[model samples]
Target chain A: MYSSLILLPFLSVIALNLPFRNLMKKLAFVVCLLVLLVQISLIVCPSICIWSNDLDIFGSFLQFNFAVDNLSRVMLFCIGIVLLAALFVQRYIIDDEERIFNFVNVLLLILIGMDGIVMVRDIFSLYIFLEITAVGSFILIGFNKDVDAFEAAFKYIILSVVATVLMLSSIALLLIVSGSTSFSSISDALKTSPDSLLISSAVAIFLCACFIKAGLIPFHGWLADTYSAAPAAVSVLLAGIVTKTVGAYTLIRIVNSVFGFESSINSLLLVIGIISIVIGALAALGQRDFKRMLAYSSISQVGYIILGLGCGTTLGLAGAVFHLFNHSIFKTLLFVNSAAVELETGTTDMNGLSGLSKKMPFTAMTSVVASLSAAGIPPLSGFWSKLIIIMALWMSGFYVYAVIAILASVLTLAYFLSLQRMVFFGRLKEDSANIKEAGLGLMFPALILALIIVAVGLFFPFIINTFILPAGNILGG
Target chain B: MRLFWSYGLFISILCIIGFYCILVTYNLIRALVGLEILIKAATLLIIVAGYITGHEALAQSLVITLIVIEAVVITVAVGIVLGIRSHNNSLDARKIRNLKG
Candidate 1:
C-alpha cells in the first residue's frame, strides 16, 4: 500500500514530462487524483505492497523498500491536496506554455521528494531525498533571474549543503554503531547502545543536524530571505509543507520513534523550542515584508511542535501533530494569498501602497482570513490547535512556557495586523488603483485554501478525529 | 609507527585548517573548499571510529559512499557558483546582498 502511494507520485512525475508535454496539466491532475485515491484506500485496506519478495539474493540484488503507515498516509494526502491545487491554479501565473511545462515538472519533482522522504524506511535513502529536496529548491529559488532570487538561492545552497554534510556525518556515525542503514535494523542496534558517553554525543550531533534543517531559533538565517525571494507558488509550497516534512517531521520520526525520545532529549528539545518561539516571534515582529514575516512566523510555529513533542504527553503529541496539519493548511493559504496580492498589485512591500480592500476585495478578504487563522483567533483552525498546545503546556506543569506561548500568539497578531492594515485598508496610493485581482491560476489555490481554512475552523471535531487522532495515537497514545 | 602517527595527525590538522578556512573566508568558492575539507576530516574520523570499534563494514562502506556523494555535490555546487560569478563578477558572499531586507 505504501509502495503504490509513494512510488506512483515519483513515477508519474517523470512520466508526466514525457513526449506528451502538451497535456502536462492534465497529467499532473490525474497523478494527484490517483495518489489521493490510494491514500484514501489506506483508511480501509491500509497496507498495499506492490513489490514484495521474500526471496532475497542475500546481498547481490539492489532492493527497493517502502511502506506507508498512518503517518505517511497523512503527509501524502496533504501533498496531494497542495499539488493538485497548485496544478489547477498554475496556468494563471503564466502565458507561456513552455514556462508552464518547466514549472509543473519542477513542482512534481518537489512532490516526489516529499513523498519519498515520508515513505523511505532507510536512513541513507532519506538523506538522498533530503538532499534532492534541498537542491531542487535551491535551483528553483533562482528561477526568477532577479537579483534577490540569485542571492537568496546562493545563501540557501551554502546553508543547506553544510547541514546536509553534518547530517551525513552523523548518519555515518550511526552506521558505525548499527552496521545497518535501515530504520528497523537501526532501532535494534540502538537497543544495544552499551555506552552512555557515545549515546549522548551521537544524539547531540544528530539533533544539531536536525535543528539546522528545521530552522530552530539560532539556525534560521536563511529562511526569511529565501521565502521572500522565491516565486509565489514556491513560497506557498515552502511555507506550507516543505519545512514540516523534511525538517520537523524527520526530527520527530528520528527522536520519538527511532531514538525513543528519552527524558534528557525531551528536555533538550524543550529549551530549543522555547528559544525558537521567543526569538522567532521577536524577529518576525520587526519585519516590513509580508512573506518574510510569515517565514519568521513558520520558525516560531515550528517551536510549538517541538514543545508539544517535549511534553511527551498524549495530548501534547496530539496537539503537536494536529498543529502540524493545521499550520500547513493556513500557512499555505497565507502564502497563496500573498502571492495573489503580489500578482495583482505589482508589489509586496508594505510601504509601497494601500486601499487594496476597495479594489481587490477577494484577495484582501482571503488574506485577512488566512492571517486570522495564523494568529490563533477563536473558532479557526489555528485557535483549536493553539488552545490544545497551551493546555498541553499547562498540563505539563510548564506555566512559564504556557504564558510565553500566549504572549507569542499576541505578538503574532500584532505583526499580522500591522501587515493587514498596511496592505489592505488604507487609502489607495496614486499608482495602486489599477491593480487587479489574480486570475484563476494563482487565485484557485488561495480560494481552496480559504474554504478549507473556514471549513476546518467550523468543523473542528471531524478534523480532530479523522486526521489528528490517528497520527497522535501513533506518536504516543 | 611514525608514518601511521604522521598521517593521522596530518589529516586531523588539515581538517581543522579546513574549518578555519570556512570561518574566515567570505568568498563562496573558498567556503566550498572549506566544506570539502570538513567532510574529508569527517570521513577520516568515521574510519578511525569504525576501526576502533571493529566495525569493518561501516568503515569501508561509509568512507566510500561519503567520498562519492561529496564529489557529486561539489561538482553541482561549483557549477552553480560559477553561474553566479558569471552574472555578478564576484564570488564573495558578503558582497551579495540582493536577497536581504
Candidate 2:
C-alpha cells in the first residue's frame, strides 16, 4: 500500500507526458495537483481503502522494499505540502505554457525522488533516489538560463557530485563488511563489529556526505548562491524541502537507524549544530539580499533540528522531527513571501525596496506571521518545537548547549526584525509606491502556511501527542 | 586481505587525482571530467567490495543502476555547461562568479 506513494507520481509523470501534447499541456497542472492532493489525503488518512485497492494493481509489477514509520509520515506530509506550494508558485510566476509544462514534469520527478528517499529500506536505493532529487533540482536551478543561475547550478553540481562520491565509497565499504545494502543488514553488522576501524570510517564518510547534502556551515558555500540565484519558485522548493529531505532528513534517519547514536556521533552533531546556528545567524545579519538572508536563516533553523537530534533521547528525537515539520512550514512560508516580493518589486535587495506592506497586505501580514514563527515567538509552531528541543537538551544535562540555543533564538529574532524593518515596515520608498499585491497564486500558499504555523502552535498538545510523540517511537525501532 | 589493501591504495590515488583535477582546473568541462573520475573510482570500489564479499550478482546490479544514473547526471551537467558557455561565451570556472554574498 505504501509503495503507491512512489508509484502514483511515477505513473502520473509518464501518463502526463504521452503523445497527446496539446491536451496533456492543458491537463498537466490539474493532474499534478490531483496527484499531490491525493498524496496529502492518503497520508492524512492512511486508513483509506481505495488507495490500498489501487496499490495492488501496481504492486504486482513493481517490488519495492519500502517501510514507512511515523518519521517518514511526517516527512511525506512536508514533501507534499512544500511541493504543492512550489507547483502553485511556479504556475503563478512562469507565463509560458511550454515552460510551465516542463516545470511540472520535473516537479513530478522530484516528487518521486523525495518520496523514494523517505521510504526506501535499502541504502543503495536511497542513493539512487538522492541522485534523482539532485538531478531534478540542478535542472530547475538552471532553468532560467541566466549566467548567475548557471554558475550556481555548476557549483551545486560540483559539490553535490563530490558528496555523492563520498557516499558511494562509504556504501561500498559497508557492503564489504555487511555483505548486504539493506539498512537492517548493515545495522546488524555494525552492532557486531562495533569497534572496527573499517565501520567507523564508513560511518564517518557517510555522515560527511549527509552534511554536505544538508548544506551545513563548512560545505554550505553552494547553498545561498543556489537558493538566491535560482528562479523564484525553484528557490521555494529548494530551500523549503529539497535540502531538508536529501540532507537533514537523510542524516537523521541514517544516524538513528543505521549508525545508532554513539556518544561521539552525538557530540559531533552537537558541535556542528552549534557552529551552523551561530554562523548562519551571524552571516544572515549582514546579508543585503532578502532571499540570501532567508537562506542563511534556514541554515540556522536546520541547525536547531540537528541540535535536537544530537541530544540522543526520545524527547530530543521527537523535538527534532517536530522542528523539521515546523521549519518546512515556516521556511516555505518565508520563501513564498520572498517570491511574492521579488515578483512584484522587481528586486530582492533589501536596500532597494521599502514599505511593501502598504501595497501587498496579504504577503506582508503572512510574512510577519512566518518571521515571528521562525524567530520562535510564543503561540507559534516554531516556539513549541524550540521549547521542546531546549527542554530535552537541559534534561539531558547539556545546559550549555541549551543556553546557546536560546541565545541563537534571540539572534534569529534580531535579524528577522531587521528584515521586517527593511522590507515591510519602513517608510515607503517613492519608487515602490506603484507596486501592487501579488496574485492569489502566491498569496494562497502563504496564507495556508501561516495558518498551519499558528494552528500547530495553538494546538500544541494535540500535535505532540498524535504527530510528534509517534515520531519519537522510531528511535526505539 | 592483500587484495583489499591493493585495491584500496589504487582507489585512493584515483580519488586524489579526481579531487586535484576538480580543484586545480579552470575549465568547467575539465571539472566535470574530474567528477567522472571520482565516480569511476567509487564504481571500482563497489565492484571490488562485491568480489571480496562473494555478492558479485548484487554488486553487478547496483553498478548497472549506478552507471545509468551517472550517465543522466553527466548529461545534465554537460547541458548546464553548454548553457554556461552560451551565456558567458567561456567555460572558465573563474568567470562564473557573479553570485557573491
Candidate 3:
C-alpha cells in the first residue's frame, strides 16, 4: 500500500501522456489534482489502515524498499500543500493550454521524485530520487524561455552537478567501508569503526554536498538568482519545498538515521546554521526585488531548522520538523502573495510599488500574516518552533547560540517590517492608482495557507502532542 | 589498500582538471564538458569501490543507472544553453550577468 504512493503518481504521468493529446491536455489538471488530494487525505487520516497494511501489489516485480515514519508523513503533507498552491498559481498566470499541460506533467514528476526521496531506505535510491527532483526543477525553472530564466537554470545545473559529484564520491567511499548502500547496514558499519579516517571523510564530504544543495551560507550564490528569476509558479514551488526536501530534510534524515549526531558533526551544524541565519537575514535586508528578499528569508528560516537539529535533543528535533512544516506554509503564502503583487502591478521591485493595500487588500492582508509568522511574533506558528529550539539550545548548554538565535529573530522581524512598509503600505503611488485585486486562483491558495498558519499557531498544544512529538520517536528507533 | 590509493590518486587528478576547466572556461559548452569530466571521475571512483569491496554486480548496475541519468541531465542542460544562445547570441559566461544584485 505504501508503494502505491510512489507508484500512483508514476502511473498518472504515464497515463497523461498517452495518445489523445487534446483530451489528455484537458484532463491533466484534474488528474494531477486528484492524485495530490488523495495523498494529502491519506496522510491526514493515518487510521485508514489501507496505507498502513504494507500490501505491496508491485512487490514481485519491483524490489524497491520504502518505509514511512512520522518524519516522512510531515514532509509528504508539506509537498502536497505547496504543489497544489503552485498548480493553482500556474493556472492563473499562464493562459496557454499547452504550457499548462507541460507544467502539470513536470509537476507530477517532481511529486513522484519528492515522495520517493522521503520514503526510500537506501542511500543510492535516495541519490536517484534527488537527481530526479533536480532535473524536473531545472526544466520548470527554465520553462518560460526568457534569458534570465535560462541563465538561472544554467547556473543551477552547473552547481547541482557539482553537488551530485561530491555526493556520489562520498557514496562510493561509504560503499568501500560498509560494502552496502542501505541505511541500516551503513549505520551498523559506522558503529563498528566510527573513528576511521575513511568514515569521517565520507561523512564530511556528504554533509558539504547537502549544504550546497540546501543553499546555506557561502554556497548560496545561485539560490537567490534561481528563485527570483524563475517563472512565478515555479518560484513558489522551488522556494516552498524543493530546496527543503533535497537539502534540509535529507540532512536531518541522514544525520539521525545514519550519522548518529557525533560531537564533531553537531558542532559543524551549529557553526553553519548560525552563519546562515546571520548572513541570510542581513542579505535580505538589502534586497529590492520582492522574490529575492523572500528567497533570502528562506535561507534564514532553514538556518533555524538546522540550528534546532544541531542541538541533538528530541525536543529540538521535533521543533525542527514542526518549523519545517510551518516554514513551508508561510513561505508559500508569502510567495503566493508576491505572485499576486507581481501580476497586478506588472513588477516585483519594491521601490516601484507603494500602497498596494488599498487595491490588493487580500494579498496585502495575507502577506502581513505570513510576515508576522516568519518573524516569530507571539501566538503565531513560527514563535512556538523558535521557542522550542531556543529552549533546547539553552538546556543543552549552548547559551551563546541561543542568545544569537533570539537576536536573529529580531533581525528577521526588522527586514519583514521594512518589506511591508516598502511594498504594501504608505501613500498610494499616483501611477499605480488603477491596480486591482488578483484573481481568485491566487487569492484562494493565499487564504488557505494563511488559515493554516493561524490555526497551527492557535492550536499549538494539540499539534505538539499529536503531530510533532511522534517525529522525535524516529531518533530512538 | 595499495590498489585503492592508486585509483584515488587518479580520481583526484581528474577532479582537479574538471574543477579547473569549469572555473577557467568562458564558453557554456566548455563548462558542461567540465561537468561531464567530473561525473566521469565519480563513476570511476564508484567502480573502484565496488572492486575493493567485491560488489562488482552492485557497482555495475549503479554505474549503468548513473550514466543514463547523466545523459538526460546533460541533454536538458544543452537545451538550456541553446535557449541562452538564442537570447544573447553568444555563450560567454561573462555576458550573462543581467541577474546580479
- Listing every candidate in turn, what is its Cα RMSD in Å to the true structure after a full C-alpha superposition? 3.8, 1.0, 1.2
Residues A180-218, model 1: lDDT tens digits: 678877777888778565456667877887888888888
Model 2 lDDT per residue over B11-95, tens place: 9999999999999999999999999999999999999999999999999999999999999999999999999999888988888
DockQ of each: 0.44, 0.93, 0.91
In terms of DockQ, which candidate is strongest? 2
Better of 1 and 2 by lDDT: 2
For model 3, what fraction of the real interface contacts is kept? 0.85
User: What TM-score does candidate 1 get on C-alpha atoms?
Assistant: 0.89
In candidate 3, stretches whose alpha carbon ends up further than 4 angstroms from where it belongs are: A49-55, A475-477
Q: Record all residue pairs in model 1 with backbone atoms less than 3 Å apart, i.e. clashing.
A: A1-A48, A1-A49, A89-A441, A92-A441
- Model 3 interface RMSD, in angstroms? 0.5
Q: Candidate 1 lDDT, tens digit per residue, B1-101?
A: 24434555876697689878988998988988988887787777667656655776757876786677677667767766876787888888776776664
TM-scores, in order shown? 0.89, 0.99, 0.99
Candidate 1 off by > 4 Å: A16-64, A88-90, A475-477, B1-15, B45-68
The lDDT of each candidate is 0.75, 0.93, 0.93
Q: List the residue pairs that clash in candidate 2.
A: none
Clash count for each candidate, listed in order shown = 4, 0, 1
